[model samples]
Target: MKNDDYSDVVMAALHVLEESGSLPNIERENKCEKRSDKYREEGNIAFKVGDVNRVLEFYNRALMFAPKNSRAIQLAYSNRSAILFKMGQFRACLIDVETCCKLGCPTDIESKLIKRKNEATVRSEMENLSANLLTGYFKDCFKFDFKSNTPIRCASSDIEVMKGDAFKVVAAKDIKVGTPLALEDSFVSSNSEKNVPFSCHYCHKMSEPDTM
Candidate 1:
C-alpha cells in the first residue's frame, strides 16, 4: 500500500482507540510492536553498513510506531542516542538518553544506557562550557558586560522565543556607552596572533606544533 494510505489507516485506528477510552486492543498493540521492531531491525542493518543518516531515519520511524511506555520505545530512544553521540550532537543525545531513562530501560541494558547517559552528559557540559567561553570572549572584545546590573531587564512574555523569553534593554536611568554593565571570565582565552606557533587552533590552548 502507498505510504499515505497506510498512514491514514493508522490514524483512523488510533482515533477509534482513543474514542473507546479503554485499553488498546491487544491485537492492534501487538501489530504496532511488530512494526516498531521491524524498523529497529532495519536501523541495525543501516548501522552495520555505517550509514549514519539511514540509521537515524529508521530509528526515528521505529520510535513513531512504538507504543508509549513500552520497552520498544525506550530501546529505540537508546539506540538513537548512540547515533546522535556519533554525530557529535551531545545535547540531542543527552535528551534521548533521558527519555530512555524516564521510560525505564530494559534491565539487561540498563547499565549500558547509564554509561551512555554519563558520557553524553559530560560531553554536553564540556561543549556548553566551550560555547560560553567563546561567547564571553567575543562580548569582551566589544566591552559588553552581560552580567552587569543595568536598568534594562530581559523579560519573556511571548511564546515565539525559543527559550520563551526576550531581552529588553530598558533604561530606567541615563546610561553611558563606556559604562561597565557586567563582568565575565572566559573559560579559556589566548592571544592567537602571538601564540599561533604554540597553540591549538580550535581551543586556543597552548600546544606544541609538529615541525615536520
Candidate 2:
C-alpha cells in the first residue's frame, strides 16, 4: 500500500490511544504502558475494517513502544504472515512463524489446528552466517579517569582501546594486557599537527584528537 495510507492509519491509532488516555491519566501516573495495548487493539479493529496494511502499521507502532510485549508482536506477526502468504510470500510467512516460536507466543486452538493441517508447508529459508568468519571496521569509545590506575573491563566483547566518554571498540579475542603501547614522538609534546594524539591499540591508528 501507499505510504500516505499507512500514515493515516497510524494517526488514527494515535488518536484512539490518546482518547483512551492510554499514555497517561490526569488523575493517575504510570499509565503509559497501556498506550501500546490500545494501539494493538486499534490494529485489530483496522484488520476487521479490511485495512490489512493499516493493521500491520498499527501493530508495528504498538510493538515499538513495548518491545517486550510478546502478545502484540505475536498477533501482528501471525496476521501479517497470513496476509503475506495470501500474497504468495511463503518465505515471509515462515519467518514470522520462526519469530513467534522464538518469542514463545502461545498459539490459540484455531492457530494450532491450522498449523497441524499445514504441517509441512513451512520451511526454514533463513541463512546463518558464522560470526567467526566475519571481519569489519568498528568505531567504539570508552571513558577513563586519568587518575584511576585500575583497568576497566567490558563484559560483552574484548575492548580494543579506551578512547573517550560513552564508547569503546570491541573485538572477538582477548586483547593482550600489559602489552607495551607505542606512541608517536609528537604525542608526548604539547605541539602536534596530528588530529589524534593518542594511538589506538586495535587499528594502531591515531585518528582522534586527545585531551592528554
Candidate 3:
C-alpha cells in the first residue's frame, strides 16, 4: 500500500473499532513503554548524526508517550537534558536534570548528570547576576565598576552614559577636555620599557637592589 493511503485506511479502521467498542483491551503500560523506548532510540540515532531538530522532536515525543514514574520517563528526560545542555539552554537543562533525579536516574549515569547539573547551575546564576547588574537603580551606572571590564571602565562621575547600547548621556557638570570616561589596560606588562628594565616575567615586577 502507498504510505499516504495506508495512513487514512488505518485511521479509519481504528476509529471504527473505537466507536464500535470492539477494540481489544491492549495493555497500555506495555504499549506506552515500547513506544517510548522506540522513539528514544530513534532520537539517539539522530543525535549521533547531529540532526538537532529531529533529535529534539523524537525525544519530546518519547517523553510525551512515556509512562509516569517509569524508567523510560527518567531516561527520556535525561537524554533531552543532554541536548539542552549542549544547546546552552542551562535553565531548561536544570529542570530536566532535576526531574530525572527525582525519577531515580540510572546509577551508572547519575554521577555524570549531577556534574552537568552543577556546571549548568553556575552558568545560569552568572547569567542572572549579569542581567541584574544591568537593571533598575544600577541601570545607568551599571557598567562603571569592573575589576575586569577593561577593555574599559567608566571613570567620569558627571557622565551617566554607558558605552555598549546606551544612547543619550548628558554630563551633569561641565566636562573638561581629555577627561577620562573609561580606561582599560591590556593584561600584559613588560620589562622592555625603560620604567622597568628588568622585571620578572611571572609577575612583571622589577627586582629590588641588593642591600647587603
Candidate 4:
C-alpha cells in the first residue's frame, strides 16, 4: 500500500485496539513488526532489480525497526550479508554472517549462511595472501637479453627453459628482507569485466558509483 493508505490502516487498527484497552507495549510491538516486514519487502524488491544502494537503505531501515532478538532482525542481517559479499566486502559480509548466527537464524537457512561465511573466508584469505605477496621484497631471479625469437616471447639469458612436472618460478638465490627488486613494465594487459561498476576498467582504482 502507499504510505498514506498504510498509515490509515495502521491508525484504524490502533483505534480499535485502544477502544478494547490493548496494552501500549503490545501496540508498539505490533507496529514494529509491521514496519519491519514492510521495509524487508521493499529491500527484497530492490535487490531483485539490482538497486544495491536502495536495497541497503531498506534493509538498514528494516533492521532499525525490527525487534531485538527477533527472527526479522536476523533475516535483515542475513540479506544484507548477501549483497555485501556480492560487492566484494568480504569482511563486512562476515560480520553480518556472524551476527545472523548469534541472533539464531532460522534452522532451515543456517547451513546456507555458514556456507556463505566459508566462501567469504576463503576470499578474504586470498586477498590477504595477494597483499603479502606484493608487499614483501621480490627476488631478482633473472636478467633478460633483448634478443628476438621466432615466436617473439620475452625470455631471459640467465635462465634456461625446460619442461617439468609443473611450472614454477624459483628464485636463483636466497635474498634478505627489505631488498629492492628489479622493476619491469607489464607486457600483458587486460581490462576487468564491467560487472564491477565502482572500479576502474584499466587501473582497477575504486571510485564512487555515481561517477560511472
Candidate 5:
C-alpha cells in the first residue's frame, strides 16, 4: 500500500505495537520473505523485457532481504553474466559465472546444462583472435596487407577484401580468419623507399604499402 493509504487505523495499530515493543517480536523471517518475493517478481519482469542490468539490481535487492535465497542468487549471477557476455566483456562474464557456480545455484540438471552452454560460447569467443569475429566495439577492423608466410601485423591503413578473395600483395602473411587487429598506435609513413610491409586487415594476409 502507498504511504498515504496507512489511515488512522493502521497508524494506531503500529503505535500499539510500538508501545508494546512487539514490532521486533514479529517474525523477521516473514517480513523478509514477503519483500524478497516482491523484489523477485519485479526482477523477473525486468528480465523478460531484456533489461538485464536492472534485473540484476532487483535480484540483488532481493538477496539483501533473503541472503540465502537460491532463486535470487541464480537470477542475479545468470543475468549479469549474460549482459556482460553480450557486451563483449568475457572476462567479467567468467567472474560472474564462477560466482554463480559457487553460490550453489543451478541445482537441477537442465539449469546446469544451460549455464554450461553459455559458458562455452563465451569461452570460445574469448579465445578467438580475429577482430571481425570478435563482437562489440573491438570488431571494427581496419584493412592492411602483409607478405606471404609472415605474421599479418596490425596496421592503420584502410584495406578491404571480401572473404576468400586474395589481393596481389607486396608481401605475404600466414594469419587466418580470426586475427584481432586495432588501428590504435598504428602509423602510415610517406617514405617511398622505406619498404614498410602491410597486411590485409580484413583477411590478415600480407601486402606492400606502395601497391595498395
Candidate 6:
C-alpha cells in the first residue's frame, strides 16, 4: 500500500478501536517485536533451504519492525551478516557483525560474531590488495622479473603487455605443453634504495606517510 493509504488505514483502525474500546493493552514495542520475530522465523526457514533472496527479504522485513536496540534487531543484523558473508560481501558483513556486537549480542553468539568479523576483515584486506596490484600505478612502480630457475620467462619485448593487466606466461625457450610454472620465491626481492619505506618490500602493503 502507498504510505498515505497505509496511514489512512491505521487511522481508521484506531478510530474503530477507540469507539469500541477493544484495543489490546499491549505496548506498541512489544507488538512490533512479536511481529519481527515471526518474520525472523520465516527467514530462518528460507535460510535452511538456501534461498538467499527470500532470506534477505524476510530478514529485512523483520528489521523494519524490530524495535531499536532490541534483541530482535540484533538478531536480524546477525542473521543478515551470515548471508552477506556467503555472498562474498565482506565489507557489508563486517559492518553488520560490528553492529551486532555494539547491540550486545548474546554471550552464546558473541564469539561467533567476533570470528565472522575477523574473517571478513581478512577477506576485505586481500581483495583490496589484489585491486591495488591490478592498478596501473602499482604496475609502473614495481617490475616483475623471473629468475634463472623460473620455468616461465617474461617476454616483455615480444608480447605487447599492458600495465595493470593479466598477461599469458610464455616460456623463454620452447618447452612441452602443460609445463608447471613455478612462481614461488623465484623473483629477486629488493627494497627501495630510498631512505624511506614507500611500501612493503614483500607484499607491497603500503603505509601512509607520517605527514598525512
Best by TM-score: 1
What is candidate 2's lDDT per residue for 1-212, written digit by digit as tens?
64546877888888999999885656633324466677778877887776666765675666565546456556655555554454334445566656666666565734652572254254322111222223221211222222222244323333345658866645536647743223123433432322222345444555321111
For residues 84-175, what per-residue lDDT tens digits would candidate 6 score against the true structure? Answer: 67766677788778788888897888988889999999999998888887896766545445343422243322223333567644445665
The lDDT values for all models are: 0.72, 0.51, 0.75, 0.73, 0.55, 0.72
lDDT at 212, model 6: 11
> Model 3: which ten-residue window has the lowest total lDDT?
145-154
Residues 103-196 of candidate 3 have per-residue lDDT tens digits of 8899988998999999999998998888787686566553444232322243445556546765666665787775546654657755654323
Error of 5 at 145 (Å): 25
What would the per-residue lDDT of candidate 4 be over residues 97-147, giving only the tens digit for each residue? 988998888998899899999999999899889878766634333333344
Provide the global lDDT of candidate 1 against the true structure. Answer: 0.72
Report lDDT (Cα) of residue 15, candidate 4: 93
TM-scores for every candidate against the unseen true structure: 0.52, 0.35, 0.50, 0.50, 0.36, 0.50
The list of candidate 1 runs beyond 4 A from truth reads 1-31, 140-212
**What is the Cα-based TM-score of model 1?**
0.52
> Which residue ranges in model 5 land beyond 4 Å of their true spot?
1-34, 69-71, 109-212
| CA RMSD of each candidate after superposition | 17.3, 20.0, 21.2, 18.9, 21.0, 18.2
Model 1: weakest 10-residue lDDT segment is 155-164
Q: How well is each residue in 1-212 modelled by candidate 5, as lDDT tens digits?
A: 55766588888999999999888764445336567667878877987897766765675576567546456555556655665555444555566666677776666643653665577566756566454456545444434333323233344122333335665433124545565333345355343221122345454554531222
Q: What is the alpha-carbon lDDT for the whole of candidate 2?
A: 0.51
Q: Poorest 10 consecutive residues of model 6 by lDDT?
A: 150-159
Who is ahead in lDDT, 2 or 6? 6
RMSD of 4: 18.9
